[model samples]
Target: SIWCLKSKNVPTSGCTFYTRHFLCFSVDSPSRQDDEHKLIARYTTRLPLTLILHIINFDANKQKRELIAQLESKNREILAEIKRLRAEHDAVCQPSPEKGSTNPTLLAELRLLRQRKDELEQRMSSLQESRRELMVQLEGLMKLLKDEEQRQAVSSYPFLGNTETVGFSPY
Candidate 1:
């Protein structure tokens, strides 16, 4: 009879049932072993399934908050810069007290300020688009996690009876 790891029928003492079909290999050198350890540590999920899911949810939330805060900060900085540029441009455009005409040097500086304002505006547009895309992606991921959690809840308790009223459903 085929035995599962959880089955009581399997012997407990040094029973190869858990490892029967698996092959064990060793690294050829200490460096290789260290590399293997690093790889495993990097890729392995050490927490239980539920905890892992919770951590993922928490991480998603944290990332969204951080993203918003970062974007807002950038937006504020860009706006302030644009405002400063506009003020400088206006000051430069004002008639010189003595010359009563736009100085060539002042005109050149105004051009540079306008160019910087345009660049900042373009950067703002790009940041807004990027934020929109990221929010959409995060929303999609949260939806998937919600669906998975619902599925898990249903599977974990068969007696729950899949129904919307009970807030649990099985697919």
Candidate 2:
């Protein structure tokens, strides 16, 4: 189902060996087909069958080298990206005067504002409590004024309390 292209012979030890130099191709069926019946050609070669094994090993080694190279490239890219991100983080988190404004001044201003806000809130709460107490006192004073007016009116009309003047005109 698989086939190699170029062939070169190399002498090793006491025998000649063939080295594979081209890419392999896969075939579902043979390149040539007979008209009468399916005549599939069996692959034949002058070189030893061990040449196929050597070719397969070479291809595997080449693929392994390529994968290692790609992995190394990706690792370098990731390391560079990490370095860039760390720099950006430092730039944002660590403020300097050269970057624009003074950090200590800004922090001090923020603290002062927060303290002022707290003081104002406390003062407002005290004022609200004082207002409530004043309102209660005002209500008590109003009730006292109404009772005194009623007493004065009853004293000024003393003859209205006499029940014996039913048929007498004492005007």
Candidate 3:
């Protein structure tokens, strides 16, 4: 039989109740004769135990997905920026002997383009570093998620302890 502790103002009479964690309850009947009867009590706390864990898990999953998307977008943007920078650098590095025919304005424009190219290269390098850091964080979060899932799965099953051990290997 299942009983909810919050149904009454106080615990029901003749019931020995002990709270375990948040949701689980350990009940023992004072009378030995009641041993045959198994009573399961679920105490509703401010928050259900598993629900909170699941909510946290949901938030972590959402954060992980968002981070992954951000990382991918950043990676693409950084790649494009790097490619653009390289093209600009190549153009700047090319020897232009048109200095004789070029006007003063054209010379200033070329100088500004060269400076802009340098700035873009620096920006690209910084973005690449940020991407690397984000990737490391993503990997760590993924590992944490895997570990949490494994822990949940292990908790769902009863611990068989040493009884489940099979043949031993001598190594």
TM-score of 1: 0.38
Whole-model lDDT per candidate: 0.69, 0.67, 0.65
lDDT score, candidate 1, position 105: 80
Q: Return the TM-score for each candidate structure.
A: 0.38, 0.35, 0.36
TM-score of 2: 0.35
Residues 81-130 of candidate 2: C-alpha lDDT, one tens digit per residue: 99999999998778676754556677787799999999999999999999
RMSD of each: 37.3, 15.6, 38.1
Regions more than 4 Å wrong, model 3: 1-102, 160-171
Clashes within 3 Å, all models in order: 0, 0, 0
Number of the top candidate by lDDT? 1
**Backbone clashes in model 2:** 0
Mind giving the per-residue lDDT tens digits that candidate 3 earns over 61-127? 9999999999999999999999999998987677467843466877788799999999999999999
Instruction: Tell how far residue 103 is off in model 2, in angstroms.
Output: 0.5
The number of the candidate with the highest TM-score is 1
Candidate 3 similarity to native, TM-score: 0.36
What's the true lDDT of residue 145 in model 3? 100
Instruction: Give the lowest summed-lDDT range of ten residues in model 3.
Output: 35-44
